[model samples]
Target chain A: MKNFHLDRRQLSVPYLIYLVLFVVMPLLVVLYYGFTDDDGNISFTNFIVFFTNSKTMGTLVYSLAIAVIVTVICLLLAYPVAYILAKGKYARKHSFLMIFVLPMWINFTLRITALKEILTMLEGNLAYHPFLNTVICMVYDFLPFMIMPLFNALTKLDSSIIEAGYDLGATFPQVLKSIILPLTVPGIISGITMVFLPAMTNYVVLDMVYNSTYIMGSLIGSYFSSYDWNNGSIISAILLMFIGFFAIFTERILNRGEKEEQRI
Target chain B: MEKTKTIIKMNNVRKSFDGKINVIENLSLDINEGEFVTLLGPSGCGKTTILRMIGGFDKPTEGEILLDGSDISMLAPNERPVNTVFQKYALFPHLNVYDNIAFGLKLKQLTKAEIDRKVSEVLELVDLEGFEKRSITTLSGGQQQRIAIARAVVNEPRVLLLDESLSALDYKMRKEMQLELKSMHKRLGITFIFVTHDQEEALTMSDKIVVLADGKVQQVGTPEEIYNEPANVFVADFIGESNIFNGVMTGKMKAAFAGTEFNCVDDYETGKKIEAVIRPEDVTVVKPGEGQLNGEVTSTDFKGTFYITFVQCGQYEMEVHCLENYRPGETVGLHVLPDNIHIIPYDTSINNFEGMIDGFVDGKGLFIVFRDFSMFVDAHRLYPDSSVSRGRLIGQDGEHIDYQGKKVMASFQPEDGDMSDDAKKGDIVGNIVSFYYIGDHYSYTIRTDNEIDYVVDDEDLWNYGDKVSVILPKKKMKYRLLEEQKQEVAD
Candidate 1:
């Protein structure tokens, strides 16, 4: 007689339940509070208050500006590093990758505290340059987030394609422009999303470096701490919507790029 | 014959990965323009290394590679007028078929119109006219292969190097691509240097075949010449199915093997040891006593085109391929015509001797005569109370004694001997005839006095034609008593 055995896929049931309870249920609770008032009455007042408050509106704009700058800076820095790590002297590349990833192993708050101390020593009274300090801190913390994806994409590239480019009379610059950069677009988009979405609302990095909480993430934290769950939930729901739109936008970019490549 | 221009010439090229071992030693070859020259060998035999050197993907450790009488050894791959279709058609996945074909041309800064025209022309040549807009991943392996060719050939390189390009395709696809590649070579009129391990691929498409083994070239000839007149035992065994035997040249154009004297076309020195190779298809079956050799059919296998019949003749098995099948255990006679017999000078790489054990002490050592030389040997484990070391017989009183003669058959592995360059301090003197670096050790064939050959596996690097002395260790040598000697001792 054949012995009964569990199908391998059935083992993932616990994980599926955990995801629904911890992830989907929390989003649903926020959505329920976002569209209701404290008296259990339907209302749009929380969203209107979030949109019209001058402090929140200015913080959102400043947060978006800083996130865009950090994402661009991280991309510009990571692309070359990832390329060198992927295609340079093969023996040294792995150790170099280890050096980049070693920082992530340390506790995140411990790293931020050390960076803040270093910045305070390098430049006296970092409070006056809060914007610059926060942007710098966010870029430093999330740089690996950018590098990890780009490095993965760059390393997985077929080396023969590069050789073929050279064989077809292409110079090094031409090969990179025409072949390497175009093929690594998915990594570029994913790296951008990982950096931009996190850097936008990560007030802990800003608060640690500048000793101030002036961003939308700080605004939402204050609301929740003061027992104004209604407004905090509204702000979080809007942020989720923005993050969802960004994900779809990047995905669309990837698909469109693929279509363009096929046209060629 | 009209003189053809030499396109590429590799002179005394040697390549080594580490400083200690050489992969290709003293290899030199020339490829004529517009000819399909194939570097054929088993894998790791440095065939791909030669192709890489020609394509400028690799540089040799020694010597020079010349193109059109100019040294191009130090030139980069792109700097040379050569292109390579890599083993698996490394097509760019990001680009379509047309863009891949036009990649090289666009770098030349050609006009867009000119690029499209060239791409379309090459696409049409490869019979992929409608595949211009198709993504590379969408095409089948064969279509991708054709696109790879079109991409390389569209550049109009002076030389094209194919590094086992058809190895990934199926059997039928490979066959189809072989003919297509041959026609492409003719139409392009460019020198093609192909590398493959398949002998049939070399025979089918190459105008000239260079057979290599262990990073050394064995022979260079046309397919017919290589098939019919193999240079050595390796080539004869590698090119086709053959029944090879140890033969002795008794007279001019006459050799004896398989208990019969056969007439051969090749003339050799009288009394010279040789090897004979006969293709399986060359043997004909006849009635008993009607042919040169009589044997019984042991087994017959139907192989679609023909039947392979295995016949056992006097302790030797010969395979015969013919249309007529015979039943198992049926008596049959086989005959090989004069032209079917091929004789090659013997090149032995192993040593075995039929000697006699002259005498042995019950608790001491033994003495044996091998090739008329009496030597003392340690007692084998089968016999107790007998011991010897370093050619000295151990006495019961712990002193050395001598045993002059014995009748025995002695054997020793070639690696168990010490070979010295100084000829004076030696047991056997010989010249190194051939040497092959078989990865771990050097296999050397040494021809001693009276045409006796001994193969030695050594770690030292010895040049060809070096005279050396070989001494076999007493502990490593093995011996057994002859039947007559045992009977005489018993009586």
Candidate 2:
């Protein structure tokens, strides 16, 4: 039994290595930097500075607002596309799926650069505003990520279940609300994650598109680039904590969904 | 108990996939409001297509389908008053049992308490009371199947279509589920149209069986009618084990076979061709000369409860199933009583002799006449000395005729009969092409030099490519004509 336990532990070695290298080490660095002074002495002054600063507080609030905006936009764009892909009677479903997935194949930086070019063209020639350009870029960059998971969930659903709903005297609108919407929660959660997290920390797209927007990611990047290592690391640690909390929360939601699925 | 009248009527329904080829043709059926009807047939016979049409998942290309006396051929599946239990039991995998069952009710804007009550009731109906809180994926195959059933029944649709719903279950579970479904049908009193290729299940559970073949309804009746009185040869063969024989009508209500005459109740005129069918269990074996057919026992199979005997009487071979045991090489008399025999018009298009035959020369002086060949000469043999002549055979149509009414005769030497008469006029020296051991005896296929195939069965096994002479008995040879041939009686 001891040897069997050892074999099982050995089988998990690669995952353990990955967790230690990426997750644990990064978190330890963030924690260490979060409480360290300018001279590298262990202190709580850096955290105090982070919490007391009004600019940091405003950046945190701005980050949350941007995350919510990105999530709502993703949901709006993805739901109908996913529904059509799931139930469309077209003969070329695979080809349409390929078209939806094609945008994801390009490098993220390249796609953001392309979006920046399009935004610059719109502002230059079409007189498009800055805030609108930011929204467009964020939605465009993360649309495929939002669509893929939602499409998978919707397509995998049993169509007969919908028919059963109709047979039971449920109208069309009611089916969409009760059956299609609630059943796609996992995909919706995943899609929110796909859009929210990236849009929160993506300073590159904001830098190219927005002027004088002082977003949280922009503030962090500016601090790091100006060589204020202590302030930058403290801000980075704060952002890391926010992301960690939500990641764990999202993981818990997913695990609960899975358990509920198994129980049914 | 409230008894509802007929709710769904399919009138002259026809479905064709390619516009030219009909998958289901002119099918008319009615389902009583609370009765369970099963559409049973082999694969590709359009049984499921019929069910789908009734469910409104598929629309008939021609004709009308009505639900509660209202035509629903144009309605979508969701608009129809029916729910379908697909073969795969397409249950919602993402939802728990309660949510899955309550999904439909919730769609109707029902109160939460009412939805919960209905879900619980259906859960109890399928005997999965505690399963309401269980995840659908965690359930066993049988449990999941029950959940699917519960999900459909909770809505209380007017008609429930089960397309081979019990097929996915294991044997033991299938038997249990069949009983459960029957009781559920009794309790719910809803119209149920079940589709399955399993005849036994259709026989055991359904109030009516609709037998389909080649996209057409072969017969529709109660289980007893389909089992006892089949409408046609296909129905008879498909429903049970039947020994079918091809015979010609000699007189009204009388048929002759293997030198014995039997009384058959058929409405056809005298001298009409017909095919007779008798179930294996209906035939009784007796002493050789006393029964309708006399033949040697080519083979016998001992099946634990009874014996299945195969007898070769002249040109016809038949199977006789009895409780008494009989052995091979024994001469057995087979009796098919008049009540046991069912005669129908022969469809010669489907059944025809397409084989070769080979036999040894038992006697040399046997005369042979080729019924198909009218003006033919033999070059390889000598003629007989006693009035050796080639004569134009005279008949009612006259001598030297060209059509089917003509006959010809050729005489040969008796001493050279081993070579001349060994190969009869209709018989060709053929090589044994193949042989199959079908339990009792070996059935052989012989390929003649004339490119004709003959199927001949004997207890004696022959090897492939073995050359042998064959004789076609004149009395055994019968022409399959488009119309009956008039026979002249000599006075």
What's the distance in Å from true for residue B132, model 1? Answer: 1.9
Model 1 misplaced regions, further than 4 Å: A1-58, A84-99, A115-140, A211-213, A227-231, A253-264, B18-21, B290-292, B348-491
Supply candidate 2's per-residue lDDT for A128. Answer: 48
Q: Which stretches in model 2 have alpha-carbon errors above 4 Å? A: A1-23, A107-128, A210-212, A260-264, B1-5, B16-23, B91-156, B245-250, B255-262, B270-275, B287-290, B294-320, B325-331, B346-491
Once model 2 is optimally superposed onto the true structure by TM-score, how far is the C-alpha of residue B231 displaced, in angstroms? 2.8
RMSD after Cα superposition, model 1: 11.5
List, residue by residue over B1-491, the lDDT tens digit for candidate 2.
56648798889999987565778989898787788899988887999999888777677999999888999998876777688787877777667789888866766678998998898899889998877788778888898888888878888888888989999899999999999999999999888899999988988899888999768898999898888777876677677677765567888788765456788776677777675777889889999887888888888889898888888887567788988877788897888778777877755342123211111122232223342222222211212221212443223444332223323233221112221124454345777755544323454555565544455555566687777554444333433213325555433
- Please give the interface root mean square deviation for model 1, in Å: 4.0
Encode model 1's per-residue lDDT on B1-491: one tens digit a residue. Answer: 66799999999999987554667889999889999999998787899989888887678999999999999998877788889899979898878888888888887788999999999999988989988899888888999999999999999998998999999999999999999999989888988999999999999999999999767899999998888888986787777787877668989899988778889999999998887888899999999998888998999999999999989887667889989989999999999998998888876435776665556655454656666245655565323444555655565665654333444566677668778888767777898876654223466777776556677778789998899888766677766654443466676
lDDT of 2: 0.73
Candidate 1, CAPRI quality class derived from DockQ:
acceptable
lDDT of 2 at A59: 76
Candidate 1 residue-wise lDDT, A1-264, digit = tens? 999877867988898899999999999999889889998788999889778988788878887998999999999999999999998756778789888978999999998888888888988878878888888888888999999999988897877778777777777888889889988998899999989988888888877875475676887899899998888899999989999999999999888766644632
